[model samples]
Structure formats: structure tokens, C-alpha cells
Target: MEVKKVDFRNKIRHQRIMKNTSAEFTYSFPVIRGIQAGREYYTTMCPLKLVPRLFKFVEDDLPPDLRAQRTLNKQRIPALARYIIDNKESYAFSSLTVSIDGEVHFEPTDSDPIKSKLGVLSIPMESRFLINDGQHRRAAIEEALQECPELADETISVVFFVDAGLNRSQQMFADLNRYAVRTTRSLGILYDHRDPLAQLARTLADTVPVFAGMTEKEKTTISNRSRKLFTLSSIYQATKQLLRKGKNDKISNQEKKLAFEFWKEISNNIPDWNLCKQKKVAAYELRSDYVHAHGIALSALAIAGSALIATYPASWKKNLKAIKALDWSRHNKTIWEGRALIAGRLSKAKTNVTLTSNLLKQTLSIPLDPSEEEIEMHYAAGKK
Candidate 1:
């Protein structure tokens, strides 16, 4: 038998337009496999290097009026790409959903039932493929491939569905994400060890007398009957502020020790915290009666601590005693009303945080900055 050379280019070339639409159009895609649910879908392995070339974020190039998918979140792509590059060994991504704009022909290579069922899924060169889900992953893969070309060989699974046109694609997008649930920030902090702040928060939750067994590890909110006074996320944010640490800042041994000491000293100075720990005061009572037990107050304390440590590093421990003298009761409307509370409702706004921290700093004899002095003047005048 004589072998004939196959012109692969000719086989894959776009077909000429026909005036009468009687011609059967088909695109043959070499797919790893295909699955059938309500509609036939093909699964293929796409190289990371080819991801950018093969998939297009059409939403970026298209005018707003013509766009089908939401605009690309450029800010998110860099972080995801960094994660991919940093954790190349362990990073895993779910399959990306794509829709091809033309009919697909799957050619089976073997007599196996599964192989025969899914044949080689083909996509014509002219057919447009839109990503319904995982556009972010596609963008990240492309960005990661630029820095780590060796990752080019790594394959990501792509699920291909024949395009049912714009309306179906839009429906597919909604259907794909209809059941998605985002992980809560507090749970992320509780479970994540990669973030220094999260790790520090977990450690503080376990080690600090005030936080020990009194930290809500999984949820952001404490239940009415819950003995936990603070949330893990709140502790994370407060400690991050106390240490003057940015989201990406590295924690040194000195910083860790300082944080440990700061929280311990704070726990000692805040009588309610000690009372709650000893069961003399119920966590619920403290939460209900004092601003100090809430996240807003903790964060305010952190701000004050930062100022105190910067201004009076040598005597900061002694100065912490001033916090014990201040009336931290929620009923102190003259002090907390416009600061931590507005109409007796707790506020977490920047202005409120500054006002509360300013009052604490003043109690510690830490001279107010000019801005703080102006705010204090405004507050005093308002009171008058």
C-alpha cells in the first residue's frame, strides 16, 4: 500500500464563503477528551505558552457596547500570575470553559467505547472561541509564561462547547458562576499559612491572654451567645496595624516579639480584657458595654499604640497604664459618640478611627499631631 502525504494546512484552512448556505461546515480539533451533559462538550489540554495566543480576552479589545463578558480586572491578573509563578510546583487550576463559534468534528483514533464516544474535537481556524469562565486564569497563565517560559510546557485543561451564539454564551457565563461561593476573609486568615499576617494572627489568637480561646477563628461575626470577643480577621487587621505592617511586609523576629509584648501589655492594661479572660466578666457583657471589646476599638487602640511606640518607645509600657484610666464604657457618650460611636452605633470609618485613637493618645500624654489637634478642637466645639 502506498502512503499519501497529508496537507495539514489545507485541511485546517478556512472554507470559502458560499452564496447558498447548503455546505456543511466543520472544524476538527485534536481534543484529549469530550463529555456530554445537556450539550456535548470537549476537553482539551492547552499549553500555558499557547494560552495567550489561543484564547483572547475579547472584552478588552471590544467596545463597551459590543462586549459580552465583563471588562478584564487587570489588577487581579498580576497577583494570580505571581501566585502561579511562585507556587508553580503546587498551584492547581480548575478547567477553563470555552465556546467555539462553529460546528466541531471529533475523530476517534481507537475502537474503545469512550474513545469512540469522544473522538478528536476539531475547531476551524476562522471559528471564534470565547472564554465563559476562567478568563482570569487565562490572563494569569499568559502573564506567568512570560516570566517562567519553562512553564510553557505545563498544560491547563480547557472545556470546549460549540458556540450557541451571543445569548447562549451569556447564559453559559451566568450558569457557570451561579453557585460559586467566595471564601470569607476571616476563614481565609484562619486557614491560610502563606500570609504572614494570617500566621501572626493565628499565633496571637493562641498565645495572647485576651485573644486565647476568645477569638472567633472561622467567622467574621461573633454570635449573641458566643463567648469569643473578637474575630480572627479583626485581630489580623489590628495586629497588622499595630506592627505598622503593610499587606506584603515581612515580619522580623524583633517585630514578632514587639507584637507579642504589645498585645500582652494591652491585655494587662485593659482590665475588662483580663476580667473576661478570668471569667469574672462575661465576654458578652464586655462586648455589649465597652467599645474596647469591639474590632473598631481594637483597631483604634492599634493606631494609638503605633503613635505611642514611635513617640515614647522607652516609656510606652508605662504609658499603657493610661488606657486603664480612661472610661472605656460604651455609655461614655461625650468621648465615644462621634469617635467610635455615632448615635450609639459603632462605626469603622477612618474619621471615627482617628478620633478614637486621638482620645487614647491624649490620655497617654502623647501630643496630638496638628491634624489630630484640629479634629479635637472640632470635637470639643461640637460638644460645647
Candidate 2:
């Protein structure tokens, strides 16, 4: 039961689509047809310039319950557009998944029976093409063209599914996203070649004496049974906080040197960290027993480091040495119960970081800024 193969002229183009919406007129494309799960689908390459004009975003006016696709998040468009614009020579985007609600035709190239699946796809000009996925890419391409009109000719892969109603389209959207999972933060940092802080974190994880052998490179959280002592993301975050850098800020050589030296100094001063490095004690023992062995300790120390450098530019390293004698036991309820732990479990909440850093600042004899004092006052008020 072979379906008929229709031959369409290669010259047939979108100009004809605009000329008429008659039943005979269709938007033609070179596509390869395939079947999956007993349903017909097509894959084609489309010019970026045609994306905005060809596939319309689901109107936000429709309530989410009634819509087939998620509403476009306009806030995300600018940054995405910038990725394309900035990395015009090397940017990569995945295929856009689309659904069509009208009639279509396929013209298989008749050169060989073995290549029958290779063909041309044509849809009626009046048909509606709604993006099921990659709506952000579609929107971003439209935006990128505004600034780099030359990119209009560049092509993006598109996946097309034929359907007649919203119910099927909605199911498509749900089914597509059901298994989608964001990569773990540490893994993202590991693979990231762009962010300067992420690059610095990678360097720290590899070369720093304390982090080299024990840093967990892929997972954000370390299990109690695991041998690793620090997470790559924690190193990334702590360095970011220590430098007071913005998300996409560039790191100078001087800043990188400062981060390396500060973490090295911290490693030298922590008794448990030194013991673990010397193999005198197990890493998990410190992690389980001391508040300072967890990621929040690094975050709190980084925050304090930033302030110490700011307030005591001449002797920040000397001030940083005071942590060697501090009691960092998890059971130190009087010192760390509210600041770094809640119910004896380490917490990384915003207030917890602030409170923990405030304690570190006080220990180093550094003065607190007004906002820190305000938050301290609020925490005290809540306690009573």
C-alpha cells in the first residue's frame, strides 16, 4: 500500500504562496517525511527570515487552559536574541517543533526508490502554523533579524506535525515536555565555556590544593556517603559572591588571583579542612559534624571575605586567620542554630547566608553595613 508520489517544481516558492490562498496554492518546502508512533511527521529546513512571518506565536490573550502552547515569555527574548547576535559565528539552536492545522502535500523526489522518504512538503498558505516547542528560538530569530538582517538567509531546522485541533496540540506540548529536565548546575558550569566566573570555578576545582581532589564536578549536592568535600557550583557561587561580580561579568586577572589566594588562605586556616587534606580524618566526618564543612560555610566565608577586603584592605588575610579557632560543630546551637542551620540541618536560604556572613564579619572584627545590621535586628526581633 504505497502512497502516491507527487512531483512539484523546485521553482515553486513562497512568492506563489502570497500570490494566492486558493486550494491549489501551497507554501512549498524541501522536506524529508517520516512516521513515528503510527503518526506522519516531516522535517524541513526553514530560513530564519520566514520564521516570524510563517509561524505565529500562540496569542497570549488565550488563557493557558485553552491554549495549545505555553505563552511566550517576552522577558527571555532579549537575552536569547543577544546569544545569537553576540555569537553570530558560532551560535547553535535546536529544531523548532511545529503543528499545522490545514491541508498539506508531499512531493517525493523520483530519482531513486531507496530515497523515497526524501521529498517536498507544501502547506496551504491560509493554514495556521503554531509552534509546539522552540517558541523562544523562533521569537529570538525574529528579533535577531532586526539587528543582523544578514542572518535572515541562515536556516534553522523545523519539525512539523499535522493536526486539526487544539486538544491534540496541547497533548503534544505536554508529552514533549514531560521528560525535559534542566541539567544540574555544576554540570552546567563544567560545560560552560562562556561565563568568566564559571571558567574561574573550573580552574579552582582543578588546581586549588583544597578543591583539586575532592570537588564534585557534576552534582550540586554531595551525598553523605560520597567522598567529595566541595561541589563545583558551591565553588562557583562562593567565588562569585567573594568577587561581588554580576552574573555575566568578565573576571580580570587580578580578580582571579584574589579568588585563588583567598580560598587557599581559607583552606590553610580551617582545622577540619587541613586534617582532611592531610588524611588524618575522613572528609564525611567533617561534613557530618561541622557547619564549616558544608557549602554554606564557603558562601558565608566568601561574603565575609568580600567585606574584609573592602574594610581592611591592608590586612584582610590576617583577619581571615581568626577562623582557625572558631567552633564550627553542627551542634553549636548557640552560635550557628539560626545563622547556618535550621533544626540541625544546613540551610542556604537568603537570610541564612546573611546571618552566617554577619557572624563571620563580627568574628573578624569587620563592621557591618546598614543593611546587614537591619537584617540582624529583624532576625533578633523574630527570636523574641
* Best prediction by TM-score: 2
Using all chains and alpha carbons, the TM-scores for the candidates as numbered come to: 0.86, 0.93
- Candidate 2's C-alpha runs over 4 A off are 1-12, 15-23
Q: Model 2 scores what on Cα lDDT?
A: 0.87
Off by over 4 Å in 1: 1-37, 61-66, 109-119
Best by lDDT: 2
- Per-residue lDDT over 219-301 for candidate 2, one digit per residue giving the tens place of the 0 to 100 score: 99889777788999999999999999977799999999999999999998986787787788888899989988888899999
Candidate 2: clashing pairs of residues: none
lDDT per residue for candidate 1 within 120-147, as digits (tens), equals 5656566788999989999999889889
Q: What local distance difference test score does each model get?
A: 0.82, 0.87
